[model samples]
Target: MYGNQWSTDGVVVARNGPSLVSYRFILKRSDDGKLFKCEAFDSEGESILESSVILEVFYIPKISFSPKQTLTVKENEQAQLICINDGNDQNATTIWKRQRTSTIVQNNCVLNFKNVKRTDAGLYTCIVDTKVGVYEDNARVIVLYAPTIDIEYFPSTKTMKCIPRGIPDSYMFKDWEHTTEYNDHLRFLATTKEGNNATLTIPQNVNKKDNNRERGIYICRASNNISSIDGTFAMQKYNLNLPGKPHFVSSTENTQYGIYLETTEIKIKFVSVPENTNYVVYKNGIKFTDYNESVLRNTKIIDTMYGKNVSVKGNILSLFVKLYTSEDFCWYKIAVKNVVGCSNYSIKLFSASLPGIPQILRAVPKQTEIAVLWNPGFHGGYHRWFIIEYRKVGDIYWSNQTTNSPNSTVIGGLQPVTIYLIRMFSRNRIHDSKRTEEILIQTGNVLMQ
Candidate 1:
C-alpha cells in the first residue's frame, strides 16, 4: 500500500510503483462536471507523461414555486408567479410559459402581472436551470367576477338575464321584487337557469295585485361564491285614461244654507275639470242633456233649471241654473259619462246663493304702510266689507286687518327696507269671497296717499 507519499491538501495523490500514480479529491456541488489533471516528470526535470480526468458532482436543484400550486384571483387584479433555484450555479435563468407553449415569456425569476384580465386564466409552467439539470414546476390561476344583468320585454312576457363572464361560470339569482336603489331581495314569479346565465320570466297575465305592483320598482339579485350584486328599474304605463273626478263644497251665506228663493241664475263652481271636457247637469233627479238652441233662445225657460248651461275652462266648471222654491229643496249631482266611465255622484243641497270673489285693482306701498284698492267681483246679493291679509316674504304666518269700506283701505305700522305680500277680498254677513290675486311690494322712504 506504500506509495512514495500519501498526502492530502486540496486533493490527494498516491504513488506506489515506478510508473503508478493516483489522484483523489472530495466531490462537491461546485466540482460537478469539472476537469482534473496530473503530470509526471523525469529525473532531469523534463516532462515524460501526463493524464487528465473529468470530475462528476451530483446534487438536487432546490426547486420552489411561488403563489402556491393552486390560487384564485379577482378579475382586473394583479397576479404573479416565481420560480427560484437555490443551487450552486452562478449563471441560471428562469423561463415562464403558458399552457404548453415552448416560447419563453420571461427570462427573470419572477413573472409579473400588473393588470390581469379574464383571458389570463390558465396553468403557468416555470423552467429553472441549475448546475445539476433543468427543473420545472406549475401554478394554476383563477379569476372571479360578478354577473352582468340585462332585460328584454315582449308583447306577452318579460325576460331578465344574469350572465357570467369570468373564469368560473357559476351563478345564483334572486327573484324580482320592489326595492330601492340600495337593497336587493329574492321574491318574484319564476327563475330558470341555462348554461352560464339565469333568467326571470314574468307573464303578462299575472294577477291584478301583481299587475298593479308591476308599475313600481323591480329588483333582481345575482350572486356567486365570490360576489353579490343587483339591478333595478321602474315600470310605468305610457297611455293613461280616466279623468280625475270633481270636487265641491258650500260657500258663504246665501249658498251656505240653500239656494235663494229670489235668485235667478245659480252659479255653481266645481274644481278639477280638465280642459275641453263636456259635462251634464242634474237637478231634482233630472238630467239636463239638451243643448238645444231654441231652449237657449227662450229666456223664460233659461231662467229655470230646464235652461241649465254648462261651461268648462281650465280646472273650473261653471253651471248656471234658474231654480224655483219648490225645486230648491232637492239634491244636485254631475256625472262625466262618456270617455271611460262615470264617477260616483257628488251630492249637494241647494240652500241659498253666496257672495262672489272680489277683484283687486292694485296695492300701493308707502314708507311704512300700504293702501289696498279693490272692487267687489260679485257679491251674491249681499252687503260686504273688505278683509286684507299681509305678510313678509317667506314667512309661514300671516297678519290680517278688517275695514268697513269695500273700495279701499290703508294699513300702517310697517317697516322700511322690507317686502310684503298683500291680498284682499270682500265679505258679507255670512261668508267671504276667495282671496284676490296676491301682490308684492316694498316699502320706501316716503308715505303716499
Candidate 2:
C-alpha cells in the first residue's frame, strides 16, 4: 500500500496489516482525467511494484432551465429559447421539443418561432443527449396579444354587439363610432356592457326634421394593453315607407263638355311618409289601372329622430274619362299603401265657373199666395242662392223672390183668381246659371166662390 505522503486530493490509503490494504476516494467530474498511483517497496524503501489507474466519471447531466423562470412573449412576434449545456461532456448533442409530447423542434437546443401565434404558447422541453443517456427539463411560455373584435347585428332586438377575444382574458371597449358615405365622422358615448361583449341599441323610429344625420356605418373599437382593433357593427338606413301613412300633396281637374260628349281629366299628387312604394288610383271609389308616371319621379329628404337624413318621393296619379252624355263628372281618389298601413287623397271632378240649375220644382197655390220648393245641385266652388221669378199671365214685368234655403220659398200678396208663370235659377259669386223649365199656376178665389 502507498503511504499518505504520496496521496492527497480526496484519496486515502491504509494498511491494517502486512497482508491487508485498502484505498478510498471521492470521485468528481474534475477527477475524470486525474491519475492515482500505488507502490509497494522493501523496508529500505526500494521500489518493488508500482501500479496506476485513471478515474473517468460520467454525469447524468443534472439539468436545469435556461431562463430559470417562465418566459413571456408577445403575439405575432419572433421568439427563441436556448438550453445551456452545463454537463462535463461538451460533445453531447442538444435537442428541443414540446413537453409531454413527441413533437420535436428543429435547430438543436434553440427553439425558434418566426411570428409566434397564440396557439404556439405552452410548455416546451430542452433535452441534452449524450452516449450515457438523455437529460431533459420543461419551460413555460406565456403569449400575450391584442384584442380581436367581431361585430354582430340583431334585427329582432334592434341591437348590435361587439365581441372581443384577447390574452389575459380581459378587454375594454375604446370607441363607438360612425362613418357616413359623405365622409362624416361621429362618436358615441357607450357606457353599457353585457358579459364579455359591448352592445349598442338602435332606435326603432327616427324623428324627422332635417336630413343631416341619415344613413351611415357604425364601427366598434376594442383594445387591450398590447394593441387596439376595430370592426363594423351596423349599417343604418331609414325606410319611412313602412309602419306609417302616406300624405296628400295636391289635386287638379280639367273638364270639357259639349252638348253630348263630356271629357274629364284629373291630376292628384301625393307622397308617402318616408315615402317610396306602390300606389293605387280610384275613379268614383273604384280601383283604376296603374299609371306609373315618370313626370313626378322626384324625392325629398327627411330628418330622422336620431338626426339622420333620408329620401322620400312624391307620386302622381292621372285619370281621364269620356262619355257620350254631358253629365259625366267623377270622384277621383289616390291610395298609397304598404305592409305597414294605407292612406288616401281624393278630388271631386267638376267645373267652378257657373252654379248648377235647381231641379224637381214643386208649387203649392193658395188664394192669395204661392209656395215653391226645389232641390239644390253643385255649388260651383262658391256660395250660391236660388232666384224665383213670377208674373201674371201675359204680364210684361215679373216679380223676383230670393231664397238662400235650398229646400223651399214662399211668395205672398198674389191676386186671387189670377194665372201666374214662374221659373227658378241659381246664382254664385260669378254669375247666374241657366233657368229651370217654366211652370204655370192658377191662384184660387177667396172662399172658392
Candidate 3:
C-alpha cells in the first residue's frame, strides 16, 4: 500500500518506500534544447517500498507581433515587421517569420520587405525561444489606401456631382473649407444606394446666410470593410432673375351694326409684362377701356387681341381716323372745344387749312340731307355752340347757320348734280378757331325730281 497527497499550488507526491521522494519540473523550449524549473514537490510522509511525485506549472511570456493594431499603407510600399517579447527572462531571443515565408529571420527579429505587394499579406507571428521555455503571439496586417474622385457639372440644377472610384459600404460627406473658420451648419444633402451611386442636392432657395455665397468644396469619403477612399468637388452659384423687352403684334377695328363706330376691336402683340402695374389706352383725348385690369395679373400672350370704345367719360376729342365701309375719310378741325372751368385737355382740330380757322368736314351725297353728330366737349362752360356753313362749288358768300346744340339743320338741298363744301366751327369764351377742313359732297340723281 502507498500514501499520496496533493497541494492546490500544483504539487503532488506519493510514498511507499522507506525514503522520501522529490520531483523537479521544467518547461521545454522549441528554438533550442533548454529547460527551466517550472515547479518542485517533495513527499512529506515516511516512504515504504515505492514512491511517485508530480509538479505542474505553466511558463508563458508577454509576447506580441509587430504593427500591433491596424495599418494603412500604400501599394508597393516598403514595410517592416517588428516582434516584441515582454517577459521576466532577459535571455530570450525572438524569431520573426510569416505564414508564407519559409526563411526564418533571426537575431534582431526584424523582417523588412523592400516592396510589399498585396500578395504578401498574411498572419505575422513572433516566436520567442527563452532559457525558461518558448512563447509566441500573432497579429493581422492589412494593405489599403484612400480613394480618388471624379466630378461633373449638372447644369439643370446648377449643381456639381462627385463620383467615387470603388465599391463602398458607407460614405461620409462634408462641405469644403478654405480656412480654419468653418460653418459646420452648411445646407447640403447626400444620399447613397447599395449598388448604383450616390447624389447630393442643393436646394434652389437658400436663406440670406447662404445667398450669393460660394458653394464651398465638398468631400466624399467612401468606406468598405477592408478599405476607404475620398473625393472632392468645388462649389457652384445660381442666378435667379426676370426676363426682358416687349413688342407689338397687330390691331383691329369692328364695324358690327349698331355698335358705336369708334368702339373698335384692337389686337396687340407684345412680351409678357411683369405684375403690379396698370395699362390704359387712349383714343383721341378720350380714355378707352382697353385695359381696366392690372397688368401684373394678366398672363395674355404676346400678339393678342383687345377691344375698347371711342368715347369714354363723355369726352369728344377724336384724334384717330375711323375707317368706314368702301371709303376712307380724314377729318380735321376735330378740335376738342371746351368752355371755362371745363378742366379737360383738348385735341386741336386744325382746319387742315389757313391761319388755323375752326372747321368740320363731311363726306355726303351731293343735294342730299345729311345729319352730323359729335359729343359736346367736356360740359362746364356757360355757352356750348356750333356754327354750320356751306358754300357751292364756285360761290364765295357762305350760307351759314348757328345752333346751341351739337345737332343742326339743312333745307332745300339740291340733287346729285353738284359738289358742295360744308364746314362747322366750335366757339367758346376763351378762344375761337377754324375747322381742320371742308366736307366734300357729290350728289347723285337716283331718286331726285
Candidate 4:
C-alpha cells in the first residue's frame, strides 16, 4: 500500500508495545496543519496496510491564576497577582487584564497592583496564546479593610456590650482583653444575631483601685480568612453597691444535773432578714463543738448527750438543759444562751423521792442471839429513823424495836433451836413506805444461860 507524505516538527505524546519497537503512536504537531492521509509499512519497507486518516494537530495552552478570589489588605495597602501558562511550547505568550479594560495592562501575565484603592476591586482575567490555540480564565478579586468597634456600658449591672463593624459572615470575633490586679474583675459573654452582627457582654466589678482610677482600656480583635481587625475601648468610672447586714435572734430552757437528768434533744427557732441564713448552735453559753452539719440541717440532735449538769447555748441565743441523777431527790437547773447576741434564757429540772435504802445485810445466827446490819435510807424531806420487828416461827405476836444507825443490831433472849422472822421499814414525812423482805433466822444448838 502507498499514501501521500505529510511532515512537520512533531512529537509522539503516547505510544504502545515494548522497547519502543513494533509501536503505535499519538502525535501532536508543534504548529497547526491541515488534514493528511497515512499508510502502515512492515520492517522490510513493504506496504502492509493502507488507510485515509485525518491528521488533526492541536495545541491546548494551559492557563492558571494564583490568589484566586477575595484578596485581604489593611487600609491603604498593596497586593500582587500572578499567572502562569503550562503549554507545550515555551514561545506561548500570556496577557493579563481587568474587567473594565480592553487593553491588557500586563502582557507578561504576572500583574502587581501596588497601593491598591477601593476602586481596584473587580474581576481579573488571564489569557495564553500558542501557535495552535488560545486559552483564557477569570478570577474575582476583593479588597478588605480594617473594622471599627463600639462599646456600650451598663453601670448598674456593671456590664458592657461590644459591637463590631465591617466584619463579614466569614469572619470570627476573637477576645484579647485583660484586667489589672488592682482593677475590677471582668467577665465576658458573647452572642451573634441577625445582620451578621456579634455582641459581646463584659461585666466588671468595681474594686478599690477602680474607684480611684478614672478609666481603663480593654482590647478586642476580629479575624477572617482574608484579614484581621483590632480595637480598644476605655471603661468609665462607677460606684459599687454593698450587701446588707445579717440579723440576730434569741430563746431558752431549764438546767439540770447528773449524767442523764434531761432529754438530749432541744429545740430552738429564729428569724432573719435574708430568711434563710445559716445559724450556729452553742452549748452551756459556749459553741456546741460537736454540732454536725446533718444534725443542724435536720434540726434534731440524736444520740448526743449534753454532758451531765450542762446547759446548751445556740448561735441564735436559745438554751437547752441536760439532766442526770443518782439520787431520788437530786435536782437540776438548765440555762441557754444565744451564741451571736449572748442573750440568756433558763429552765429547771426536778425529781422527788426518798433516797434509796441500803440493802439489808443477812443476819448471823448465834446460840442465844441473831445479828443483822443495814445502812440507813436517805431521807430527803422524809422521816429519819426506821422501825425493826421480829416474831418467832409459829408465833402470832411480834416483838418491836427501833434503831437510827445504818449499822448492825443484835436481838438477845432468843432460845436455842428456835426459828424467827425479822423485818424493817421507814416512814417519811411524805409517805409510809412498804417494809423490806422478811429475813429468816434460826438459833444455834447451844444451851441458853
Candidate 5:
C-alpha cells in the first residue's frame, strides 16, 4: 500500500485524490537494478493487474586502488603505480598527487616514475573526478636505494649497530670485522647479524690471548644483493685502539732499493703509531743529528719512510741529500722512537766513476791528413766514448776531434811532410779520463810513409 497505486489515489478530486499516481525516488549507481511496480485493484479487491519498471541508473566514475599499496625500487630505476577504475562516466579525469603537496604528479590512471629517487618516498593520492562527483584513494611509494651502512654506537647497551639508511627490510647484514689493517690482517668479530641485526658487543669476558680485541678500527656492513653504484657497499672507519709502537710500512712497488749519485733521489713515506714519534737519521754508522758540509763535495740528506700512512698522518722528516763526489755515497738510515720502543732502517748508496783512458791501435798518414784507430777502455760504471787530440810536432796549440766509433777518428788539413803528436782519451757525462801516452806521426807525398 505504500505508493503502489495505478491511475488514482482515494478517488476524490483532481487537486486531492483523482490525480494519476507515479513512483518517484532518488536513483544512484547502487539502485540500477531495483524494480518499481504499480497495481490496479477490482471493486471487491479480489483480483489485480500490476505493472513494473526496472531502474537504470548512471553515475560518476570511481577508481580502485592498485594492488601494491607500497612499492620499493632502487634509485634511478623505473617504477610506476596503476589505479584501476570502474564507472559509467566517460570523461573522468584521474590525477596523481603527492599527499604532502598540492601539486599534481601525474594526470592519468597510471602514475609513472621512470626514475625513482629517495626523495620520491611518501604517500601518493590518486584522484578521479567526473563532472558530477569525485573519487580518490591513496597508496604508498617506498623507494629502495643502495643500502648505506652506518655504525651507531650505543653506550648504554655497550654495543654498536650497523644501520642501513635505505630500505632495511630488503637488506641483510653481511658481517662485522676488524679493519684496522684492512683485509690482510682482518679478523671477523662476533656480531648479532643472525637475522636482521648487525651489532657488535665489545668483548669483555675474554682470555689473555684476546686482549684488546675490540681495539683498532671496526667495520659493519650491509647489502641488498644489488650493486648499482659505488656507494652500494659502504665501509666506514672507526678508530678504537690503545697506543702502539712505531713501524715502517712498504708499498707494493718501491724503487728506492739503491741510490746512484747525481742521477736520483729517494722519498720514503709511512704512518707510525699515534703520538709524538722522534725520528733520527743516520749516516754510515753515526747519528745524523745536524747538517754537515763536505768541503770536497756537497751532499744533501732527506728523511722519508713508508708504512700504513692511514689512521694518523705520522710526523714527516724530509731530508734532501745532494752528494757531488764518489766518497759521499755511503749507508744512510732512519731511526723511529716513541714511548713504547724504537725502529731503525738503513740504505746503501753506490757511486759512479769516470771512464778509463782509451788506447791507440794504429795510425795511417796520407799526403795532407792522417787517420787514427783506437779502442775504448772500461766505462767505469758510466756511459762514455773515445776522443782523439792532435797537434803539429813543434806547435803548442792542439786540435781535438770526436771519434765516429769507439775505435776510430781522423785529422785532416795538415802539411804533407809535417810531424804531428797525437793522443786518445775517454769521456763520460760526469768526467773525462787522462790522455794516453803521446805518439808521433808523419804525413808524406805518396800514400802515408
Candidate 6:
C-alpha cells in the first residue's frame, strides 16, 4: 500500500502473522492508471519489497439523439440529425445511416439535409464508437406528404392498376374502396406492395347485378402520424364493335368448275353478319382492287376466252366468269372490320378451271371382274367424258376405258386376290385435265362350290 497519502476510503488492510499481509480496494474511474504500489519493510525499515499494478475498466458506449426524442419533419424542409455520445474516449467516431440504402449519409456526429423529401422518411440509425466496441441506436425520421395516384388499365387482361404514393407505405393501414355511382358495389380484386409503393387492382367487368353501372372508380386514403392524403381515379371498359369473321356457306357452283367456252357466273353464299359492318374481299391474299373492275363488279365478255366478275350482296357473295384464266382460278378470303377492329379471314375458297378429281362411291369385287362406281367433278367447260385407267399394283402400264356416262365402270379379266390402282381424267377438244389421285382396291377370292 502507498504511504499515508493513500486514501483510507474503500481501502482495507489485514495482517495475519509476522510474514503475511494483504491489501484490497474497489476499482474507480480515477483508478485507471499504473501508479498504484505496495511496499514491505524489515526491522531496519529499509525497502524490502515493492510492487505496482495498472487498473483498466470496460463499458458499453452511450448513444442519444440530439434535437428531440420524437423526430418528425415536414416534407421538402430542411432537417438535421446529431448523434451525441457520452464515453471516456474523446477520439470516438459517430455515423448516420438510413434503412433502405447502404450509402452512408454522414460520417461525423451531425447529418444535415437541405431539403428533406419523402424518400428520406424511414428508420435512421446513429452509431457511436466506444473503447470496447462500436454500438448503435435507432430513431425514426418521418416525413409527411399528400398521397398521389397513377392508374393504368389493360383491355385484354381486363385489369386496372392503381399506384399510391405517400409516407408510411403500408397497405394494411390504408383504406381502399371501389364503387360505381349506378348503385353497383365494385370489388378490390387484389393489392400488392413493393418498396415504397402500394398498388390496388380491380377488374374492369361491369356489374351484372346493377343494370345502369358501366364504369368503376377506386379511392385510396392513407395516413401516418404526421398527415393524411387521399387519391381517386375512374375506370373505363373498351368496347369492340367489329363483327366476327365471315364463312363460306354454300356456293352456286361447287369449289371446282368445268372448263366451258360459254360465259358462266358462280353464285356463292356466306355466313351473315351485322349489316353495318363492312367486309374486305381478298383473292389468294391479294386485295380484289388489283384486278379489273369488270372482273369484280359484273360479268362482261371481252373476247371468246376472257373476262371475270365478282360481286357481294348482303350475305351472298358471287363470282362471274366469261372466260377461264389463271387470275380467276384460285381461293377467296373474306374479312370484316368496323369501328372497333378487324376480324380474321374466313376459310379459303378454291376455284379451278380444270375438271376436278373424281370420287369413288363404291367398288364391288365380282367372279371375273371388279365393278367400280364414281362421279366426275368439273369438266372444265363442257359435258366432257373422263378416261378411266386402272392396273394391277405392280403393273407399269395401265389398262384404259372410255365412259361418257362418268358414274360407274367395270373392268373384266382381273385375277382374284389381286390389288389394283385406279385413276381418271377429263378430256375436251381445247385441253386435257390432269389425272386424279389414284385409289387402291383388292379383288376377292373365289367361293368354294
Native-structure RMSD, model 4: 26.1
Q: Residue 381: error of model 6 in Å? A: 64
- TM-score, candidate 6, is 0.33
Clashing pairs in 6: 258-380, 258-381, 259-380, 259-381, 260-381, 295-308, 295-309, 296-310
Question: Considering lDDT, which of the candidate structures 3 and 4 is the better prediction for this target?
Answer: 4
Question: How many clashing residue pairs, candidate 1?
Answer: 13
Q: Model 6, 234: alpha-carbon shift in Å?
A: 14
TM-score: the better of candidates 3 and 4 = 4
Best first by TM-score, ranked: 2, 5, 1, 6, 4, 3
Give a tens-digit lDDT track for model 5, residues 1-449: 22226322323211111224654546778776666555654556533566666755657665666657777667788887898778766677889999968998888888888878788988999888876678888888877666666677775555787776666466666557664433323467777864555778876533422222344567776777656455556555566544445544443113232234443443444444444346777777887654432121111212222222323233434455666556557777877676766666665655556778888889999988888887787776545777788899879888888754777767888888888999878887667899999999988877554
RMSD of each: 15.0, 24.6, 27.5, 26.1, 13.8, 21.3
Tens-place lDDT digits, model 1, residues 1-449 = 22232333335355443466665656677766665655555665454665666765556677776766766787667877777767656776678888788877687888887887667778888787766688887878776665555444342445555454434566665555542112222234456877666665655433422222132235545565554333222122111111334323232112423345443333333333232245566765788642221112101111111122222121223344444556554555555433333333444544444567777787888789888887766655555677888999999888999987767888889898689998877777567777877888998887555
**Per-residue lDDT over 317-353 for candidate 3, one digit per residue giving the tens place of the 0 to 100 score:** 1123333332222111111112211111212222121
lDDT of 4 by residue, 245-308 (tens): 2212223233322224543334333221222344444333455444222223222111111121
Which stretches of model 4 miss by more than 4 angstroms? 1-58, 66-79, 87-93, 100-105, 116-122, 129-134, 142-145, 149-196, 200-449
Q: Which is better, 1 or 2, measured by TM-score?
A: 2
Which candidate wins on TM-score? 2
Q: Model 6 over residues 1-449: C-alpha lDDT tens digits?
A: 22222113334243332355555666555555535554555656555676655555545667788696447788778988788776667677788878656778899888787888877777877877777799988878888665555655554554445555655444332434544322223444345654444454443334322211223345544343444332232222222222333433233334534243344444444432333256666767877643222222222212110121222222444444444564555665556554434444433333335566677777787655778788777665545777878899888999988878878888888888889898877776456777877888888888422
Q: Point out the higher-scoring one by lDDT: 1 or 2.
A: 2
Better of 2 and 5 by TM-score: 2
Look at candidate 5 and tell me the lDDT of residue 205: 34
- Residue 64, model 6: lDDT of 82
